[model samples]
Each structure stands twice: as structure tokens, then as C-alpha cells.
Target: MIKQMPFVETDRLYLRGLEEEDVCDIYAYLSMEETREFLDLEQQQNIDQTWNLLYEEYLPYIEKSLFQCWVMEQKQSGKVIGHLRLYEEQQCLFVEMLLHPAYWKQGYMKEALMKMLQHVYTFLKHQNVYVKVRKENKNCIFLLESLGFQYITCVKEMLSNGKMYNMWIERLSEKEWRKQNEKNT
Candidate 1:
């Protein structure tokens, strides 16, 4: 399949293709205690561990699958602050994002997420977008809810790291997105 690269521009951030160089930036958050607290994996202890996860695991799976990652960069400093992954699974487009703690509460993630939601609606024409978050990830839950995603149900799954998670699945339908956009306009 031919890849159609996505270049999404938001007011405060730019969503561009994620490269291998971004592994370090991604590890900045993945290595943190607070960020990993709700995540299924233990906090990364070294760069090698992060590299293995990103290179040996995720990269291969993403390469063969209908998935792409966008690294969020600050337009002013050109610093990578986070990354997001969009993939198709079970007939739904799924979006997952992670942001550095230093940049949290600044709305960058929200900006990137909004842009991708529009892309899914416009380009992918997906009926719904789904996201699964740990129930304890209050910040993520709040962000999803604020974006008009409805709580679908709770599910439990075992992570690759041998940990189990109680997650809340949420979804934003095309109808719901259209409704939200109508209100905004």
C-alpha cells in the first residue's frame, strides 16, 4: 500500500511523521514515574529498554499494519513534545497519544487530537474513533470526555509487560463529532 503522509498543523503544534530520532523524546515521558503510574509498563530504566520497545516491537507492528505515528513538535522551538498513533482495528480508527509531562496542561495534545479527529472524519471517513484509557488515568479520561467521546465500557487486558489494566473504552462517532462541530461553529 502506498503511504499518504499526514502533515497536520495546529495553532500551537505541528503533527508530522515520527522518525527514529524521536525515540529519545518519547522516552522522556515513558521514563517518568508519574506518567508511567497509570500505564501498564514499569517505568523505563534506560534508553536501551525504550529503544527496544520502539524499534524492536512497535516499529515492526506499525510497519505491517494500518498505522502511522505523528510526532508533535512545538512550532517555535521545534522540540518534540509527544507522539500519537492512529490505527485501524476491529473496523474502527483508534487514536493513542502521549505527551511529555513538562508540556502537559498546555493544550498541545488537545490541539493535535482535534486535528486528527478532523482528518479521520474528512479523509478516513471512519464511522467512529475509539480510545482505550486506564481508568486511573484521570487526565486522559478528562481529555477524551472534553472532546465529546462517550464512555462505552470497562475492559481488562494483560499488557506485554505482564501487568493487567482495567481500562475504560470511549468512542467519538461521526454523528457526535458533527454535533460538536455544529455547536462550535
Candidate 2:
């Protein structure tokens, strides 16, 4: 099992491990049609389904420390607004993230991801990380590009929509991220 991730904080958000109380807030986004479109998750019908997903699908792996997941809480309101999950495979880390539509375009996801990337490269000592964004998810693609991730390839992925869709695989190397960090700093 991998080590549990440490808490991460940013200017306006705190990224911490998941808790049982987070189900409701997570359901809010998972049930939204807008948020579900870009994600590969099936649209949840009710809170129970969300609970099942958390307890059965996610928590087991999380408990084993196989996957590092965090709930993004707004520092001011102390509300759970989003979540991020990651796992490493064959020396490359993979990322999955979701945020409430209400928080979209506000840089909340970017803030959380930037801090997460710092942790991955600095503390976790990962050399590279990757994320897969749907072709239609322009906002996410733009965000990844802004973070110094380069397009590796495009593949047809089966999404919640039940159809194969174009997905862009983007990768960011630690060396590249450090160079960009230096420029921005």
C-alpha cells in the first residue's frame, strides 16, 4: 500500500482526504447533468447511489492507500466543492478530477491541481503525471495546457454516455513543470 497523502492547502482551498460526510457534497456534482457530461462517471440517480459509489467503489482502494483522493473544501465557507483522485501505474501517475458546476471557471480546480502537482513532484517524487480529458471538454483541455501539459495522443474512450468518444491524453513531466514553475514564480 502507498502512503496516505498529506493535506494540501492553497490560497482559497484545502485539499484533504475524503470523509463519510463528503457524500452529500460529492453527490451534488455527480448528479448534475453538466458535470456528468465531461466525466466518465455514470449519472447518479440518488444519494444512495452516490453513497454506494463512495463506500464500495472508491473507499476500498482509498483505504488500502492504492489511490490518493482528496476532497477540495473552500477555506472560507468550509464547503466541499470538488474532489481529486490519483493513482500511479508503471511509473506514471494518472489524475481524475471533478468540481461542482457552480465552481467552474473560477480557478478552483486549477488552484487545487497546481498544489497537487507541487506535492506530486516535490514530495511524492513522481517524474510525470497524466490526465485524460474529453475532446469536448475545452475548459479542462485549456486548463491542462496552461499547466504545461502536452498532448500525447487521442483515443476513443467509453464515457458515461455509453458511446465511444474522443479523449485527449495529456502528460506533464516534472522537469517541464519545474521549468514552468520557475518562470511563473
Candidate 3:
């Protein structure tokens, strides 16, 4: 249902496709234990794993337009600070994001997501955008809630990684997102 990931820009960041050079920066956060705490992924063991994930997995998927993976690049530093993945299934659009710990609580993610949400609701014409967060991920829950995402329900299931956890399903309707955007502006 989705096609190419278009490049998006905000005042402080650019959301663009992934590149080989981003592997090291991606590894920097993916390898951290704290970073993986609320995520379903295991802590990345080494740089090669991140390389394989980007080259063998992410790049091919992006090329085929299977899913959209965006690299969040800081405009001032021109450095990759995070990554975002978006996909649709069964008529529901889902979004996932990760930012380096060094940039945490800096409002960079909020900026990136606002741009992405605008694209999702406006250009894509999706009625609603959804995100699933582990229940214990208070920071993520707060962020999504602040963006007008409403709590849907909670699910307890085994993830692909063979881990079981309580996951909260949250959604933001286009109308509500537009309302929130209008308030922000």
C-alpha cells in the first residue's frame, strides 16, 4: 500500500533514506543495553551485525519499497542521530523510531515525528497512524500521547525475538493529528 519514502525536512532535521555510512552511527545506539530495554530487539553485539542489518536487510527492503526506513540526520551537524521505520499491514499504518542516547530529551525526535506524522496523515492520506510501545516505555508513551496518539489497548504476546511483554497499542487519527498540529502552529 506504501511506495517510496520521500525525503522530509524540519527546521532542525532531515528524514532521508538509509546509507552505508550510517551503519556506524546506527550501531552506536543499537548496541547499547539501555537502548534495547523497552524494544523487542536484542542489544546488537557488534558493528558487523549492524552492517548486515543495514546492507542485507534494510537497503534491499527500501529499494523494493517493501517498507520505509528513514535516517534522521541533524541539519547543523549533518550527522545521523537516529532511524525511523514505517510500514502498513491489513490497512493499518505503523511507525517505529530509535534515537541515539546522546540526543535523548533534546526534542529532536519530536521534530522528526511531527514531520513524519504530517506526511502520513496528509500526503499518504492514511486515516490513522499507529504505534505499539512496550507498556513500561514511559518515555515513548509520553511522546506519542503528546503527539495526539490515543491509547487503544494492550496486548501480551511473544515477539519475534521470543520475548513476551505487555505492549500498548496507540493510534492517532488524521483529524486529531490535524487538530494537534493546528494547536502547535
Which 10 consecutive positions of candidate 3 have the poorest summed lDDT? 59-68
Model 2 per-residue lDDT tens digits across residues 1-185:
35466888889998998888889989988999998887778889999999999988667774665675788999998889999888765666898999999999999998999888898898888889999888889999999999999999999977656789898989999999999889878
User: Candidate 1, residues 95-137: lDDT per residue as tens digits?
Assistant: 8787888988888888888888888888876789999899988
| Local accuracy of candidate 3 as per-residue lDDT tens digits, 25-75 | 889899987777788776779999888877765788747666758899999
Clashing pairs in 1: none
lDDT of 2 at 66: 68
- TM-score comparison, 1 vs 3, better candidate: 3
Best first by TM-score, ranked: 2, 3, 1
Q: Which parts of model 2 have CA positions greater than 4 angstroms off?
A: 62-65, 89-91
* Backbone clash numbers for all candidates listed: 0, 0, 0
Assess every candidate by TM-score. 0.88, 0.93, 0.93
Cα-based lDDT for every prediction = 0.81, 0.87, 0.87
